[model samples]
Target chain A: MGTVEFAGVSKTFGGKTVVQALAEVDLRIGEGEFVALLGPSGCGKSTLLNILAGFEQLTSGSVRFDSRAISNPGPDRGVVFQEASLLPWLTVWDNVVFGPKVQGVARSIYEPKAEAILKIVGLEGFKKALPVQLSGGMRQRVGIARVLVMEPRALLMDEPFGALDAQTRLSMQQLLLDVWQKLKTTVLFVTHDIDEAILLADRVCVMSARPGRISREIPITLPRPRSIDDLTNPAFIQFKAAIMTEMRGAHGAH
Target chain B: MPLAGQLSSSLLAFILPVSLIAFWQLSGTNGVIFGGALPTPDRVWTAWVNWAFGTPTFGLNPYVGTWLQNVIFSAERVAKGFLVAIATGVPLGIAIGWSRLFAKLVDPTIQWLRPVPITAWLPISIAIFGIRDFGAIFLITLGAFYPIVINATQGARAVDKNWIRAAQMMGASQAATLWRVVLPAAMPSIFTGLRIGLGIGWTAVIVAEMVAVKSGLGYVLWDAYYVGRMDIVLADMVSIGLLGYLSDRLIVALSGWLLTWHRLQSFNQ
Candidate 1:
C-alpha cells in the first residue's frame, strides 16, 4: 500500500481572498518512493509539501497516511526546512535527537541511532558544536541528520539546499541522493531548480503559480543508484529540457 | 592572545575615572568652586574612613561606625524586593504575552498603575505596612515589577513562528514547547528586563528608606543632610553608586555566563 495519499486536496488561505493554494490535487506515493514537486516561486509546491507534513490544513478534500487522516505533525513525517532551522542554542547532537527525545523514546534506543545518522551526514565531530558555529551547508547537514534520526516513514524536504551556494547545493544534492538511496524513504521534495528536480527525483511534478495546480508529471528515465556524475549524461539533459519546456509553457499560460 | 587583549582593555577602562578623581582633588585644593558644603577629596575620604572605622563617641557622630549596618540593611531590602519582583513578574509576563485573554484582563490595570511614581506610593506603603521593612520592600517590588513584566511580555510575544512550528513538528506538547522553546527564546529579553527592574528596585528602596523607614543607606542620607553633615551625605551617595554599579556588573556577568552561546556567535562574527 502507498504510505501517503492526497486526494483532491485544496487549500484556501482566507475567506475574503480565497487563494486556491492547491486545487483538486491528487497524488499517491508508495513506500520508499522519492518524488519531487517542482515549480516556480508561488506555485503552491511548498503548500502541497506543507499539507503532507501536517503543517497546514486542507480547505477541501483529505490527506491520509497509511489510510488514516493526517491531522498534525509527528515524528512519522520529518520535514527539512530551506533555512536549515536547527535550534541555534542547541548543540548538533541535541538538535538531531530532539525528535525521539520529545516523543518519549528512551535514550538507549535513540542515542546510537542519532550517532549513526550524524556520521552519515558527516557531522560526527561536530556533535557538541552549536548550530550558529557551523557553515550553512554544515547546518543543513545537521537538519537532515535530525530528521533521519527519527526513522520517519517519509521525508518532506522544502528546498532543503536552496539557500546554499551553487557548489554547496550540488554537494548537498549528492549527499541527499546517497542518503535517500540507502534509506529508501518516501520523499516529497519541493524546489524551483529544474536541474535539481531532474537530478534527485524519480518523477518531477511541475506546478504553476497563482491558484496553483500540477501542470505536468514528467518521469525521469534515469537509472537508479545515480550519482552527481549523471548531471552531464544525455538522459539527464533530456529530462531537464522536458521540465524547462513544461515550466515555460506554464509561464506562457499564466 | 585574546585574554591579553581583554586584560589591556580592562586596564584602559579605569583611566578616565582615575583622571576625573585627580582633577576633582586638584580643583578642590585650588578652590575652583564652593568650598564649604562641597567637602574636599581628603575631607570626604576622612569622613568615609571614620564612618567605616571610628568608634561611636557618645552619639556625637552618628555617621561614625554605622556604615556597615546601614549598607547591610539597604542591600538586604533591595535583594528581597527584587527577587520578589522577578518571581512574580516573569511568570505573569509570560502568561500575559502568551494568552490574549490574560493580556486583555491584566495589561490595562498594569498600564493604569504604572504612571504613579514610586515616591507617590510611599505614603500608601507607609499607611499599609507602617514604618517596617515590608513597606520598603513593597515599594521596591512595585517599582521593579513594571519593567520586568513589560519586557518579558515583549520577549515572549516576539518568539519566531517558525521555531514554534518546528517544536510542534517534533511532537512537543503545548507545555513543553512553552517551557523548552518559548522560554529559552525569550531569555535574552527577560534578562534585559531583569537588569532594568533591579536598577529601579534599588532606587525605590532608597526612596522608601529616606521617608518611611529609619534604617538603611537612604535613611542615613536623609538624616545626615538634616544634621548639616553634607560630607557623610556625599559619601553615602558614592557608596550607593558603587553598590548599584557592582550589582549591575554581577547581573551582566551572570548573563554573559548563561548566554555564552549567543555571545560567542556575535563575538566570533
Candidate 2:
C-alpha cells in the first residue's frame, strides 16, 4: 500500500463561501519517497501538507496513510512548520524529548535516541539552551531534531527553512539532505524555492495556485548521496531551468 | 559588580525620602502647613518605634506594640485569599480560553461582576461572614480573582497553533496537550497575572480591614487617624507601603527564579 494517498481531496473554509484551497486533488506517495510539492504562494501546497499531517480536515474526499484513513495527528506522521515554533520556555533538550515524553514512552528508550538526534542535528553542546537563545537556522535544526526523535514513519515539512538567511538556508538544506539520505523515510516537503525543490526531492510535483492542484510531476534522476556541491553540477542547473520555465508557465496560466 | 550596583541604587533611592523627612520635620516645628496636623518626621519615627517595641500599658494605647499583630493579620488574609483566587482562577481561565462553550457560559457573568469593585463588596462580605477574617479574605479573593483569571485566559488563548499541532502529532491526548503544552506556554502570562493579582489582593485586604473587619493595618490606620494620632497613622501607612513593596518584590523574585529560561532567552537575544 502507498504510504499516503489523497484522492479527490477538497477543502472549504467557511459555510457561506467555499475557499477550494484544494480541489479534486489526487496523489499517492509510496513508502520512502521524498516528494516535494512546489508551488507559488496561495497554491494550497501547505494546506495539502496540513491535511496529510491531520492538522486540517478535508471538506470532501479522503486521505489515507498505509491504507488507513488519516483522522488526527499522530506520532506516525511528524510535521515541521514554516516557523520553528519551538516552545520558548523549553530548552533544546526538552523540546526534542517533548514528543516521546508526551507519548509516555519510557525514558530509557527515548533519552539516548533524543541525544543522538541532537548530535546529528549538530546541537550536542547546546541542549540546555532555550529556542530564543539560538539563531533562526539553529531553531529549525531543533525543530527537525524534535520530530526525528519520534522516529516518525513520514516527515511533513512546510517551508521549514524559508525564514533563514542564504548561508543558513544552504546549510539547513544540506543537513536535511544528509538526514534524509540516511533515513530514506517518506517525506512531503512544501516549498516555493525551485532550487530547493530540485535539490531535495526524488520527484517534484509542481502545483498551480487557487483551487490548487498538482499540474506537473517531474522526477529527479540525480545520483544518490547528494551534497551541497551538487548545486554546481550541470544536471542541477538544467533541472532548475526546466522547473523555473514550468513554474513561469504555471504562473502565466494562473 | 551587580551587588555593588544594587547597593548604590538603593542608597540613591533613600536620599530623596531622607531629605523629604528633614523638610517635613522643619516645616512641622514652624507649623508651616495644616497647623501641625501632619506629624513631624521625628514624631512619626518615635511612634513607629513604640509600635514596634513598647509594652502594652493596660492596652490603653492600642497602637503600642500592636503593629506586628496587625501586619500579620493583614498578611495572612492576603496570603489565603490570593492562594484561593489562584487555585480557582487559573483552571477556570484555561477552560474558558480553551473552550468556546465554557467562555460563553462563564465569561459574561465574570465581566458583569468585575465592574463591581471589591470595596463595593464590603457590605455583602461583612453581612455574609459577620466581621470575621473570612469577610476580609472574601473581599481580597474577589479583588484578586479577576486579573488572575483574565490574564490566564489571555495566556491560554494565545498559545501558538503550531505548538498545539506539534504536540498532538507527538501523540499527546487532549488532556496532556493542555497540561503539558498549554499550561507551560501560558505560564509567563500567568505569572504576570499573579503579580497583578497579588497587588490587588493587598489593596482589597486594606479596604476590607477599614470597613468589614477591625484588626489589620488599615483598621489601625483609620483608628489612629480618628484619635488625632497623626504620627501613628503615618507610621501605619508606611507599614502598608513597605509590606506591599516587599510582597511585590517577593513575587518578582519568584518569577525570576521560575522563568529563568525565558529571562535567559530575552537576555541573550
Who wins the lDDT comparison?
2
Candidate 2 colliding pairs: none
Best by TM-score: 2
Off by over 4 Å in 2: A15-18, B1-16, B265-269
Candidate 2 lDDT over B1-269, as tens digits, reads 59999999889999998998888889899998758679888888999999988887885789778889999999999999999999999999999989999999999999999999888888888889998999999988888899999999999999999889988988899999999889888888899999899999989998888888889998898888888999998999889999999998998899898888777866776
Q: What local lDDT score does residue B106 receive in model 1, on the 0 to 100 scale?
A: 98
TM-score, candidate 2, first chain: 0.97
Question: All models: lDDT?
Answer: 0.89, 0.91
Assess candidate 2 and give its lDDT.
0.91
In terms of lDDT, the poorest run of 10 residues in model 1 chain B is B33-42
Structural similarity of chain A in candidate 1, as TM-score:
0.97
| Shift in Å, residue A250, candidate 2 | 0.5
lDDT of 1 by residue, A146-251 (tens): 8888888889999998999999999999999999999898898999888888889988898988878888898887998898899999989988887788889998
Native contact share for candidate 2: 0.84
**How does residue B199 of candidate 1 score in lDDT?**
93
